[model samples]
Target: MIPWVHIDTGTIPNGGGTLRLMRRGQEFSIQLGQNELMNSRLSGSEVALAELACGRIAARSGARVLIGGLGMGFTLRAALQTLPERALVEVAELVPSVAAWARGPLAEVFGGILDDPRVRLLQTDVAAPIGAARAVYDAILLDVDNGPDGLTHPGNDRLYDHGGLGLARRALRPGGVLAVWSAHPDAAFTRRLRDAGFTVEEVPVRANGRRGGARHRIWLAARPDGAR
Candidate 1:
């Protein structure tokens, strides 16, 4: 058996826990404490998060997408595949080292997707961009801190709160989608989305595509046509 080897460690930014990178033969993993945040082998649900959202706005021209986290580029690659050639995908990664890991030890996993013209990677909190404009993005996707309570950064709760949800609502154009990925289900959040004026749909997807693995949740919330 090939034993797991610790490759590197990085701070999660904003006083979050330490992020450790590990490798066992061909597979790689990024973890915080005992929670495995991401692994090279399990990317199905993450990809689904982008496919479900971008699939909705694929036909639109000049589409813009804001992705809150850049974990191994699975979601970003899926978004790139789903959207049109002219679309723009902005990935806001709270930790700078996460981006560096994407380019360094994890480069093969990304397949050079970061070099795509449609992508703009930023090393900062996602909230700034989400609140920077009104009705700008065609969709806003959040994979931050595993469904909003902050496994890494405590402030991530704001993104799921009424105010943060409102900010996401305000940042999106009418009919835009807000897709969020979570490790587990949270029913209260569904209600919050409803109160925030988004038509919400929660999807259950497997971790390793159709092959079968742990299940994950994805919430697709759509801004109303009449919403500002």
Candidate 2:
């Protein structure tokens, strides 16, 4: 059997962990430790989540979208293709090394989209934009840290909490959509979305185009019209 080569990427300040890119022949994986974060193996669900998020907000002009995490740029690219010319996308990525990899080694995965005019890639946490903004974005799509139940960073757990959900609610326009991609479903989290004053719905998605394989869940939440 061929060995998987490990390449040192860099480190994250907040997490106090080193980033490594592992490659074995045609397959590539991103890992913070023993746990695998994302891979090139399956991305159909990611694409579908992007589409679902955009569909709810594409009706409006001058749409402002915030994409949490820029994994391989599949979500961003799909959004760019769906949104109008007047639309803008701000992608917040916590790890600078992941951004570097997208632009440097894994450029082919996104076809030089790191430099796309529609995309504003920030090397910061997604919570920053979510907290700082004031009812600006029409859509906020988050695929960070697997899901509400899965915590990649101890701090990321807050993003699923009431406070973080409140921040996300404040950052979005009235009737705006909050779409989250998860590896699986969490009923408790769905209830939390409703408690946050959002109309929540769960959609099961597969990671195959016509031919299905692994299944994932996408949670769609819409802020109330009177929600501030």
lDDT of 1 by residue, 51-136 (tens): 99999999889899999999899999999999999999999998888999999999999999999999999888999999786999
lDDT of every model, 2 decimals: 0.92, 0.84
After TM-score superposition, what is the CA distance of residue 25 in candidate 1 from its true location, in Å? 0.5
**After superposition, which runs of candidate 2 have C-alpha atoms over 4 Å from their true positions?**
none
Local accuracy of candidate 2 as per-residue lDDT tens digits, 4-77? 88865767657657768888777677887786767877778888888999988887898999999887788898
> Distance from true position, residue 14, model 2, in Å?
1.2
> Model 2, 13: alpha-carbon shift in Å?
2.6
Query: Any residue pairs clashing in model 2, and if so which?
Result: none
TM values, all candidates: 0.98, 0.94
lDDT of 1: 0.92
What is the Cα-based TM-score of model 1?
0.98
